[model samples]
Target: MHRPAPTHAKHCCSLPSPCKECFLVSFARGGSWRPPPCPLAMGNTKWADAGQASAIAGRRRERLIPRSGPPVRSECLDGKRGETGSPHQLEGKTMKAVMYTNRRADRILQFTSDFPDVDWAVVWSPEEFENGVADADLVVLSNRICTPELGAALARGRTDRLRWVHFSSAGIERGVNMGLPRDIPVTTSARAKAPVCAEHAMMLLLASSRRIWEIRENQQRHYWARNELNFTMRSIEGQTLVLVGLGGIGAEVARKAKSFDMRVVAVTRGAAPTPDVDDTVPRRRMCEAFADADAVIVATASDPSSFRLIGSDAFAAMKETAYFINIARGEIVGESALISALRAGQIAGAALDVAEDEPLDPKSPLWDMENVIITPHVSAAGSTNDYFRLRALFAENLNRFRAGRPLDNLYHFDDGRALPATN
Candidate 1:
């Protein structure tokens, strides 16, 4: 009494657009049959048969954004999709993505080349993002633009179609504070700017070690400072350099440090012995690592646990002639303790590319200190290569998303909140 489903050959329909929806075709003996009016024409997206089996078993598509749960630091969330979740529904439809960046349009245009099928909306502010984000299936932006208000709006379902978020920065901690949804996957451009960041750290170390700033000042004054310069100028050949973090940047710093023939001792959370480092000190023994160091560099990722990780005790344990370099986040080093150390000669000097607050306060004593060197956090600049690399990464992730494959650079949160990037 039940009739079997019939398959029609060369099916045709009078729908307005080519939609990825199932069709019921009744075929006669000769394979000539009428294609039923597509139910998709009525705007009902619930598919019946063909779309059900599209989700692959191993491809987990859980949200990477955090939910409105009790204030929990967002962890790397990954889970398999349910039986009904199918990317096939998005195949024929114009997959729209909203990209927020202060970067140029040509770079964004390359994304269009990679995904010709997708419609991208370029925005620069949260207001712009909110305007067109309602229809977006994906959001690509810098970590700085991901404000808490924007995140809250997304969590409240302001954009039901959003599937993923990509940050154009290596620092995932900034994005973590945005309270992104737990179900949406968030990715960063990890390792993209490592080479440049490492170069900057080395530059700071070398400048501070050889008293380059002092030499330059003496030259400007037309004063012969050979005697004074020789007094403070130290040779890096046999000195011990302590690197606080062993992430991409820190690893590069280690490599460059070895080229100078300096002994490298890394302080990290159980980092494996890297090629350039001669010794390893666990984070538990950070103060111990600083004891005899000629220079200590902080390149760790910024997180709750990392805030003020280096303070009075760590500075007090260092040799009086030791130099402190921070190319990482500013808050990682205790500002007050560092100021005290610099004033009291607890350490020789300090080089900071980042500070407790950006554009350091005018009244701060660090500005006038002869031993301190401060640069406006521009360590990641001077490289167009990083931009191209990020473009390629974004394209790859886009393709992977469409193909139902897992993404790369999955930033997993740990109990420490600030997990070492080496992991």
Candidate 2:
């Protein structure tokens, strides 16, 4: 018998749980933390040993921060189809869905090879969409859909066939502003992001320890004059690490950060304990956490409350030698403030993979700084499979939707521009 749908307020996911599922949410939360509105905690993991994790200096730990926001509405199995018009209220302009547009070359290759059966368009410009987007079956918008015109195109395609979109990256900052169609299911590239980001965070931490970048500069200037070492090089074996944002990518960064024997502390919405996270703290106390950290890695997803989460004040509070690494969104930190922190030597340095204005201009002053290392939003992505993998995950979710099975990565009901569920 079909059990009466439980009230949305009592549980997370705002619905009954799915069984025999490959995509799962697993964690301990005293039974109050249900899976909905995205995760507040990841699976709990034990701290790593400094003795076994060779050549590492810091201890490993993790934590969480309670986040507050309006509780999103939930729906039943077959809610009414969303209205066919621009979701203009969310963006204050029209939003439109577009086609495949991942930046990574490998993901492009793998996605095409895997989805040979699905007929999809790979349009590069809006001008090429002459027939108008409403007629298209599906628009596989990659990460590049952060523009106002693309928003208009998305606004134009407010009908059937615009059911799903596989975002190119895991950050979801672009998605928060996309005004996703209410009925369409938007999924993230989170699964594909974890490992690559973990590796990058670890690399920055290790590089800082070995003095690789500064050593290179001395060599380039041919300054071979002998002198006593001025600064002490630290080890990862017994120091502390505080990771901001404990989602898929953040968790992976934590696991690897632990492998280096560093303590892992994390901040997330709704105070709850999860595997690998130590001490649950509030966002206000983040600077205090940083003051004691040897390395700080931020891998948070972009949400309404997260814009400009870090600024110069936080940097000023950090130890002068501490290294700050951001593999998350760029706007999360103030660029002007970052420059001030680095130039005044308030903090040792920063290793950034993303910037406020991405593909940072060649004329930007960040290029001239000796203490900062900037990569063109390349650290968190590693393979072409992130796209193919996301597409396949979406395909599986599509199958579930068709079978009247529960959906995975269901965009929490908020303001979105979606089509009727496409099974």
Candidate 3:
């Protein structure tokens, strides 16, 4: 059954100029009001009851009108509303959005209920997604449930109704590789995840610099080796740190690194000086900058051109005592080259939060290396704070989408990267 229109005056017409005859206004003005005749009343002019009239009225209001003008008198289901030629507005019809998520269904429903005009469907599995996406006007995708096959299906199965695709995570390289429809606008939650991921990178850098694994080994043996480790222990203070790809994550890392008195040099396409970076070098001269760094971090996006961007030559360019850390996608660094660099002691040590292939081959030599620290890609794992940030970002974007405004963190299909945040 259709839901009833709101009875309160404030909940009546949201348009700029509401019709004077709208019954909701009469209710507020303490004037006598009667149910209007609905076309759906069994082909009769009169409704069966007040409840039936309300249901019909609610359905009519669900058909969204243009934002700029007064409400127009038009048929609800006949598609005869005023045309604004705006991609954002869905004239004369309600929008249906299908979201694939692992979040609790009740929570999603409660949040979506605020917008009665939108029909929201939340699915938990790939099978449900295949069935639910058929008539959807918008799709909210979770990274955990996304795959190349599903991406291809989405691209192929897209209808004229499909307008936008949103990712709940920072990384969209995998989504880009999924062959999503290029014409539809795509966005991500990268801005929300940057600070947490940067903190994780700093943790890895500090642990690697102090040789935490060796300290743990001594503790396990019940031995005191303070003097033995002291000579080798290093501080990040006054060391030069180089960052590749100064996007959201990179910028955050640079800002935090400066707090430790580290000199930050960033390699980016832009020539403008960044806030936290002490020096900026073009991508072509990144190797020259690497030669002077005491540590290097990979925080760039992964694309075809950037695949294996830090290979043997790049590693060989770093100082022998310099540490290497990869908090970004593993494919951005050649795994074999990194392994070789570690084995030959070309660099002091390395830390990895992501791998080229996750669940990283149990037999891989990196597992046994004394100098290497490997985490199972849990850098952005603060559930409590992350949930709120992701929700706020999506909600803001949804509002912008309805208002015909440009979205934040828009993913570029041509480059397989998000538009860098202007602020």
Candidate 4:
């Protein structure tokens, strides 16, 4: 039986399934909090102590301002193929898709409605997928569950029937870290959720720029620190924001940066010049852009080539007053280098949404730094519309796959990253 959509009201009290899932939503009401925002309200005030169970900063966390656009219509699954020209047509064959996820009820129901023709298997445990992969034609994986055993199973040809793998999130660094085979064509929901993550990047930038972390720390001690914050606070309007990638998330960040009257410089992998960027540079020349930037935002994808790209040399290139922001994978940065830079005042401050080692070890210096703002990988949260958009993309891609068309957001195995959609 299909669960009906929640009431289409301006404010919804309905919570998303998998409540503990990171990148979740939190809505606000007049003054009084509806439900407690994140689990951070518990005794653990330090982000590092919260470990893998960390949520976006509690009630005080900024909400994602809704995007101005028409709502996307959900595609009905009725054996009517998509009109998009596909390169790989399924002909009359039906594909078998196995999803290994903890989001059982809502996700399973949505997948069923979207791909009614395909054989569906929802494996909630690693054991289930280990036993079931041999017959699966497609597998949808999330970063959290891409364990070593699963990777070995997929790599060892346990699933000759598996033609493709789809990752739910933008970062496949975890899959790469798990030693998953790079041969299978993979796709990610990277493009679908760019706006949400970009908005988060801006949030961290603004919060760090305005010294929100210090204000909160002072608030806890009942100390009036206005004079101190005034010295630290800065405006974004005249600043230069250098984005590390010019992909969907970087493009959105550029667009929003323009609205604030900030100049946006981008470093991309030879992607065409995007509209909002003031200038573009190849990744090799990113250090030049960093030298002049007021804030260096890491929005690049993590891959074999990009691991530890922002080491001591990258930090040494930045202006002493400039802030460092990472909305991308933490491995893209050298944790020790960032800490050393922060301690030595090589950079004014740093804001990080992702950490090199998540749950970030309790002894990490970042947790104790007054100039740093640490969030537990929740930058992609609060996009209520993402579920609809993600499902729509998958359905459209499923149609394309059946038609042998190039899938959208196709992960390039050779490049070890998601390629820009061709369809």
Q: Quote the positional error of residue 407 for candidate 1 in Å.
A: 2.1
What global local distance difference test value does model 1 have?
0.67
Off by over 4 Å in 3: 1-89, 102-117, 420-423
The Cα error of candidate 2 at residue 11, in Å, is 37
| Per-residue C-alpha lDDT of model 3 across residues 257-317, encoded as one tens digit per residue | 9999999999886635667899999888989999999999999888886889899999999
Q: 2 or 3: which has the higher lDDT? A: 3
lDDT of model 3 at position 310? 92
When summed lDDT is taken over every stretch of 10 residues in candidate 4, the lowest stretch is 24-33
Q: For residues 1-423, what per-residue lDDT tens digits would candidate 2 score against the true structure?
A: 112322334423433431101112221111122432322211221222223221111332221211111111122224322111112221232333345453454344344433333444565655544234665544555555566566656676545655555565555556556555656656654555566677887887777765667678778988763452245456788777888776667777777776776677886654245566666566788888888877788877666566788897789888988888888888888888988888888887788888889789889888987767777877755653244235434544434433445555444544221112232
TM-score of each prediction: 0.73, 0.68, 0.75, 0.76
Descending-lDDT candidate ranking: 3, 4, 1, 2
- Residue 64's lDDT in candidate 2: 21
lDDT of 4 by residue, 1-423 (tens): 112232224213333322221122121000112333222221211122112232332322222221112121222233343422123324344576788877754443465544555677787766778777777778887776777877776665445667788877777767877776566667887766777898999999999889898789899999999888888899999789999987768888998899899999998887777778889988789788899999999999888778898889889999998999999888899999999999999999999998998889989989999889888999878886566456556755665566566776777756665664443
lDDT of 1 at 234: 89
Could you tell me the lDDT of residue 118 within candidate 3? 60
Q: Itemize residue pairs with steric clashes in candidate 4.
A: 86-404, 86-405, 87-404, 87-405, 88-403, 88-404, 88-405, 89-403, 89-404, 90-402
Model with the higher TM-score, candidate 2 or 3:
3
Query: Pairing residues by index, what is the TM-score of model 4?
Result: 0.76
